[model samples]
Target: MTALHDKAKGKVNPVVAVGVEVDDAGNLDDVVLYRQQAPHTYKQVKYTVDSRSPLDTSYLTGPSKNGGPSILRKVADAWVALTRDGAPVELALVTNRASSPADQLLAGRDARTMLLMPAAAEQTRRSERGRLRATWAQATNLTEPQLLMLLNVLQFDTARDLRHLEETTSLLMLVNGLRGDHQAVRSGADWVAEQARYGHRKIDLEMIETAVRDQELRTGPARSVLSVATLKPDPLKTQAVHVLDWVDRFDGDDAFSKRRPRAPFTWQQLQADVEDIPHHLGAVPQVALTGSLRQATAFLIGATLRMVTNVDLAVTQRGQLWESAADYDQATHPILAEHSLGIGEDLALAVEVATPMTDDVLVFLRTQQVPVDRLVVLQPPRGAKDNAISTPAAAVALTVGLRDQARRSAKGHPRIHLFLAGPMGLSLLLGHRWNRVAPTTVYEEIRHSVQYEAAFTINA
Candidate 1:
């Protein structure tokens, strides 16, 4: 599992170290913390697989080669242990086995009968309960009184019809792929040599389930709870669709519009027309920048630019990084005349938080020909420190200072352009503070794109 975490790259949602601890025996289990939805929430997942043939009741009752408890009952016992431990978890039982009508995969209280059926209750007596003493004794301490509690807690989820499900895994391939992952599971014995070291590295099973659920959402029969948990409405994705529509219209591809010179808009107007729609952008009513992570800011910027903007950014003077950007701008982007809106104060807010870089962003903006009538530069306290805002209180103080500057600079203007050059956490918090201050369009640095573009609208 740790190796899998190491192998992951790019913007993949990495598991949070906190709240993702596993149980005593962790195979293809799931416990994650840092997702966009349900941050810090804990989950426990257990897996079972069967690829040989369709299951009669025996697959649930039959022991593995060494005659230990079956994986299904073991996982069920684990669930009971987890509940008893008071660890709040969303437990799941994942498997790739098609059970016959005789052996159904029931859930909750309905699942209790499987234990009473001939495969279990009758067999327990048939073996004179010796098998239970031999295998489940240490693991579950299965006494007669605890049998009902065991049945009540052990709700196993089944994946039926392997050949048709499209996502079924070969038992061997899965085991081999997880070759070195021994840290999560410690209770099992390697059946191969009765002692040869064997364990497969595992990841959170929820990751697989999430991907599958997302696919279901795209194709069919998406469960509402999961769909709501994983998919968020994106402003840029919507605006990108609209942009593609413009491209089609301009190309005379729209069935409704005939190719004509008299159309109200053209291909060149795609940028202008799309940039004009502000109030109708951003799913969130307010945006924030209170994270130190660049990816968060980058996402917010990309989404916002798609909604409403043509930005006039300023990158302040802050040593080599800013200098290099300024030099690049001078080399590639000779300033063009600003678009004449002839309305309100075409405001420009400078963000000198964390460091001094408003001038750098501004120079890049000039290359794109965006205009700014006023400059609202935000700064930290006089002698209080370096770029870091020091404390949450200080971060809030900076937010207040910026808000005041925004109001004073824009005067009574309905809209103002904001450029952020600060710690990601501070930026997000600033966005939250500006939530009440409507129509404050936020800009993001494109880093490598030759021309500057509006990243997204930041009303929220």
Candidate 2:
């Protein structure tokens, strides 16, 4: 009966082009781009009249060479299917000179960009298409047409300047997905706090805390030591206390018994580690190693080198860059020409404990549109790691780099000052009078020092 109806109606087989659409839940809603429309009925009729089922020179009078009613019908059919499935669909002509008009149009563009509501909204606005999201951040999932439309908008000159559009779009989309009421971004604050208590750090917490602490870190020379801290809940603290108590309880030792002995290595250990790593890799050489910070600084830098890289302390001192800053005046002058102490990727990843300060790094971060978090102090030891210590040199460099990056990322995203330091390094940064100590001891001391220091607390 279906075949006889086709014969009487003079209709022939049609071509098919499918597009797959997906929502936030990752559901697929494909739309057929090509379908036969009523206007193309006459062409189908002509084909039916002229051709037999088995012998077809021109079986179906498809759309005109320029894409007539037949192709439009196919598109309409697909659109109807999409609408029926509760998927967002829109109609528009895409250009294609090299292939069939139907094929020339995209079935779907990159899928990642589509899942974002911001991208989808921008797509609809640019294409003059239907509103998929009721608000700027309202899309939970996206349809194929919506995704394609967004892709097209991104390709436009006007939208290209939107820095980190992909990231921002995705974040906004996620926020929308988690949004409860129409008014505010839902609070995962409790979850985040829990994670913090468990010693787990989240990027969002880092971002938010960084934003909050930026003002404190940037006060400059007057505000020498800026501490950006994320506090844990009482339960986590209680758990930590219990563990400490357990260890002490087992040892039957008092608080003083938990104290550590002085480290065997001196500031000279720093030079050894620095020289072992290549200069291009951003390893330090001979440090002037002095000041109150000397012991803690040397232990940290040396321990980090030993931990991340297996190079021996002896092998560290052999590098040409490991010479004293005073002795290498000529070399220093020339090397300083570069205007920044840029560390290699190895060092960066290795020394995740404390980041480095580099104008280029800051600029690079800004160029990538990275959000500013709290200030991360990235200081290079200026003196011999074994002997010399104490100075705000490292902190200064780190702050400069962080500020530079923040300004470039966005004018007012807020800034975060992170004073990353070895135990002694932080003390020097804080300009405190303290005895030389082991790296581990310094870590505990500095950690507690920041907590107790009245000056470290900001008005906010």
Candidate 3:
């Protein structure tokens, strides 16, 4: 579907042919996409009905269930054979399984490139890196350098379920002026299966077009869903026909021990991911957002898909749905009570919606010696507490009031230090309405501590 989408979008040297079950001496030869004057991508698709098991380093390097070569060894051997002709090739392991949080080496794999990150690669003597190098070399029976070389071209395309893939393919068909209905999707799959059965290993663009025309598939509109999660999967994901998973990039065995992503870079990566949603879904008009995101991340997502964009958004907050296009009675909603402190060049804005955080924010400001000329606290009418703003209207109202306060109070300040202690929903609403303020620095509170760290500085 990705290849088809790229071709429809007129990608340079797009895939011209695809082969299924080709007689290649490699496990990755199940599916191969041939591009014009570019490296061909060989993919191995693995699907497990059990979602409990995740893909980890141990599983990848462990002996196959049938007692042949390990998964890693098969791919490594394939790489050696394919690259023998001095041609560049790409190998992919496409699976529905999630990545294991317990695997530190797997955690170092960059989500975008599917390659070992430079930072992670540099730590060769470190526990995870060293172990990865040793384990991979031993499993593949290859030298360290050879193992690294193979890994450079290896891609892990994980966390995509069958339903998601089907929906994506249907949507891609619609985008490419083909039928996108359920029947069309089933027909497409059946057609591929029939071709494979007949030993028609190679399929060209003409064959795909002919099949689509012969099947008489019709195009239709499609909606896309984006799921942004941290601690767990979002409940609203089940409501979507298909979902794009944007789980956290943190590495750890569990939520309590999860390692926070490095500031700025990880934040930027997340921003890039959110920004790419439109392109990924071929500019679907409506995008439903579901997630268990942190306040900062939620805010970032909202800011990236702000009100001015062509895409409309509907987000699930605390089990209630909030539509960006919904109309609300601004007068009936609760307004924030603001408190001001002594003035300075940099202003501190503390938005306390779920709980009180003024004291902690003040402590962090003073301890960190953040240059603050003034401080402004925006709280509920009574005060910050759990479930301060219950309704979507109230959430939007509070966000509007907070935005107004920030803009009015930040007139003389060059930068605003934003400290938020609130529901993720409120933060997202606030971010959607955030605009025309001074360069702002958003802070994330270090768990179990009063200290706050700068997570993202939004200059726009």
Candidate 4:
């Protein structure tokens, strides 16, 4: 598929051919992307239907079945042999398996290049990245420098499930003026397999074109996908037509850990970027959002891309799809229990869905001497907990109820200080329905601390 995509794009010199099963003794000889002037990329494809067990450091360093060499060991031996000639080459491990949740080392890998990011490598010796470097060096029988060098050229193309890969291949075929149906896909696969079986190790653009013509493939219309992300989504949906990447502005050490933007200017830049999406994707009725974003940021995005704009927004949360335009039973959903403090001129509203944050909000307000006469606390009827609101209907109902509560509670109040502790979906839903409310100031919790900071204010 890579070869076909490159050929269709008229990529010169760098990639001229692709090889399969070219070297029996080479560890990364399964599939090779041959480049004329640049480093050639050799890939080892590993597919597994088992979704329960993920690839971890233990699996990589442990012996394979029948006590064969470990996965890392084989790759290291291959790297040593290939680099002996002073030739710059790249190696990749393409797998459908996912990385382990507890695997710290593999967690530092960049989603796009699959290499350990520079930020990860530069961490302290006691950090997860450092431990990965040390462990892999010892396991591969290579010095730290050697291991680092190998890592620089090694890539991990993981989580490429067969279905997604097939879909991507079909899309690529269609975009390249070839038949994109399942039968066409099977034909393409058969053609490649026949070439390999016939001892034709290398295939060039002409061969690919001839095979396509002989197969009598058809072409279809083009399609596009728009992805908006603050943090890169793993196994980034290959279907995206354009990706607005803001990961560079963030520390790339660990995806699970909490970290702030690289600079204060990042937020402003993000706002500007979000504002430009409509112009960039003119007439596109829908956009898909995937990222690890702050509640404030999510709300801001929703407020910017309101329903009146005629662009639908969709996000995947907890394996379920939530869309701004999706229908819901507003009357049959979880009801929010609201607690109101003493009446005052200004309002302090704290919405806690994932966990209880009312106590902390109260402390922050009192300690900081925030001038507010009324403080409203809204939470689930039972209490706050994760997955408290499971369905989209519940989420929508809660957001609407919260909005109405705020308006009613702040009837005399001119300003509302908002502190939210909930899922991103709820935040976005609230922002989308935010209207006729008092001017609100949102607060963000400082990382690794109990304190809060004013992130931004919104008036809608």
Candidate 5:
């Protein structure tokens, strides 16, 4: 990346600071740094020296490697850095290693780590410790898609030897080459203890980039740090990653084994891990809309351009975009036309329950004559609370209604084109219901003041 952006010197954001040690301990293996451009947003960079050996997902998801509790300490340091100054804390992770394919590390199904989630939900009359408490988060086993969305790990080709010291013997080779001597340095402290000090600390992103490109260390997929962090819609998600990393670390520690962390617990780590991975690959979107979020409410936009199979999707709320069919116009219809996702589809469903945007979306569909019927719109009671879906009960009720409407509409329509506006919880709830549904396409409206910039095709 440094090499790719070398010509545009100022364009490349230099790492603010690189730590070779810890707060008060020995030399830490991991590194923590923030981009010069986006401060308060930090990421933990951990490097593993493989010594010419091929690397794999084990380095990231392994029990001993970054996947284990060892990541806890690194996350703790990052968390401290994030909260120490009281900045709008956001966390992301980047692991620079050589000889590994980015795809295998990210989408390799075999490498998926099964995270333990309580099989039950809160409000259940569960035991304190005897019955293993039913309030085990409103989630099931930690899935790969969920994990990647949460663990947005970015991998770059960086060799350990190159990062460590760049062959100390070459310490003098540059000077020798400069003098046309072509001789290697005899010794480190022998030749010139003070000479090494002259430029020993002189290093920059350009230098690293140049060297990396010259040596062909960059492999697999080539993506920039900024490329991975452009659209971090949610800061809290990153925090969740941090907290989970802490818990993952704490779960092994003897001191905090018996006691659990407080609310916003495991949130910090979770936020850090999931925020950045999507920009680089679209498969794992802007964190899966889980729990009771009406998945159709706040669209899920996954950008997996580089990946072979990236799901580009979006979900809208009922009242979020439009009121009734009257909202549709020549201007708004183009935005939907630009989406062109299910442009030539069999069916169009407006998730009217999530929000009131269905009317306009439906109008746009009908105006374009894209096969939308009266049953395309799915809405709730006229006077439902604005924040009605905050509860699981409300979301479930909406889902039940959607199932009925969708089943009735699916009788004739083959492909599903969805335009929605709803809450995040309802969107997530909608995500679960689509597992067995037809090929559904969704849309996210990146709106301007009075209009939208473009209609992003959200993959279902």
Candidate 6:
């Protein structure tokens, strides 16, 4: 009999069991046996038996494989050794006529009864496949939007099959092609406004209406909407829909009719501005410079000048990083712009701009998953050392250390190059990480004159 079957029977036969344990009830519970320990000439004579019972009783039968009669004889001998004068205490192995070979044969026969039942095997197969698909979806880069759409479709459906559901969800996602960010809407509006500049009679009436309604909802209605459509005659009108009748009347796409026109500066202009720094700084050396000190000096010189002289400078708060670029301008304009950089990419210095807070630039950069080789904050030059370095290098070192420490604490290891440069700082302050140490020039002064320019290579 199998060990499990023997354990279930509470019968520990020494000749057939290898190891054994008994429960508190003195019934055999578990067993392992010396299956072929005995020589072929006396195989049955040298077998072992062991068992444990649910009652915590233990029973171990020595190798006594001489046959059923021999096992019976050993049990009788053990029983005699433990019991005397009809005391009836449970300790020794005991044999009764009811626990014969017929009982063992019956248990063996009934074990296969459940195994022969139908559908159990098929159910297990289906459950395993389901578990595998769930694990795959979680491990893979399945997007939240895809998952949400799947859930949405599933919310109302007669066909709840998994294959059909996944396909349908994917189709819906492709059809949508992802919604545009607030920045995109703003850009589109600006584009529409520019298109209106051509004095074309065409207008995206729906877009204008949406924009107008949104603007009215945000600011007071008189600025955006023609009038409020109210259901109640009372002054305390609670139910109202903002109406933008004037939006459809615009037949032009120019700056006058559109909300926001083309960007004041083009990409070419920005790139030119970025490159013109060194040219403006001039060949005259303000002080001896090399390495990061030189880079930091150049960056600060350019950033500082800009911040001081430029009046149209925008200063976005630290929280703008969490928003879309379009929403960023709406929230705070002229100083800073914010947009997502995507997974695994750190935020890029898309536009060189000073934020509202001092650490805002550093904090935003470090939040990126990509490695940052250096952090150079360019502020407009000020009379009071607009570019002052907290010397002894401790403050700069602390800032760098804190940034790295935060990254490490979050388990996202990234190596960062840091520099703190103000009016009094030098390029060597940037250490070995500064790639360019060009001579300062007038262009540096002009570029740094704006408060919005950050100095760092984006890919770097």
User: Which candidate number would show the highest TM-score if scored against the true structure?
Assistant: 4
Better of 1 and 3 by lDDT: 3
N/CA/C clash count, model 5 = 60
lDDT of 3 at 451: 70
Q: What is the lDDT of residue 124 in candidate 3?
A: 55
Clashes of 3: 4
lDDT per residue for candidate 6 within 1-460, as digits (tens), equals 1222222222233123323332211122122232223310110112123221211001112222443323223333333332334433222222211112222111121111211112211233246433332332243223433322222211111112343333322222111121123443344346545544665323333434454345441221110001111111111111111121122221224313322112552323333443454354333222111111123333332343232232111111110111000121111111222333343422222212222233444454445333433333333222114222233242234223322332332233132233333222222222222222222111111112232223343111
Error of 3 at 276 (Å): 14
Where does model 5 exceed 4 Å of error? Answer: 1-345, 371-375, 382-385, 448-460
Which candidate, 2 or 5, has the higher lDDT?
A: 5
Ordered list by TM-score, greatest first: 4, 3, 1, 5, 6, 2
In Å, residue 367's CA in model 4 sits off its true spot by: 1.5
TM match of model 3 to true structure: 0.53
lDDT agreement with native, every candidate: 0.37, 0.25, 0.71, 0.72, 0.35, 0.26
Residue 68 lDDT (model 6):
31
Question: Runs in model 1 with CA error above 4 Å?
Answer: 1-73, 76-90, 93-345, 382-387, 412-414, 435-439, 450-452, 455-460
The pairs that clash in candidate 4 are: 225-241
Residue 280 of model 1 has an lDDT of 36
Error of 2 at 109 (Å): 21
lDDT string for model 5 (357-412, tens) is 64466445645566543335555655223664543344545654565556556665
- What count of clashes does model 1 give? 37
TM per candidate comes to: 0.32, 0.16, 0.53, 0.57, 0.30, 0.17
Q: Per-residue alpha-carbon lDDT of model 3 for 175-195, expressed as tens digits? A: 344555677789999999999
The residue-by-residue lDDT of candidate 4 on 104-147, one tens digit each, is 77787887668865544677678887887788888999988888
TM-score of 5: 0.30
lDDT of 2 by residue, 300-342 (tens): 3333333224222210111111111112111111011122222
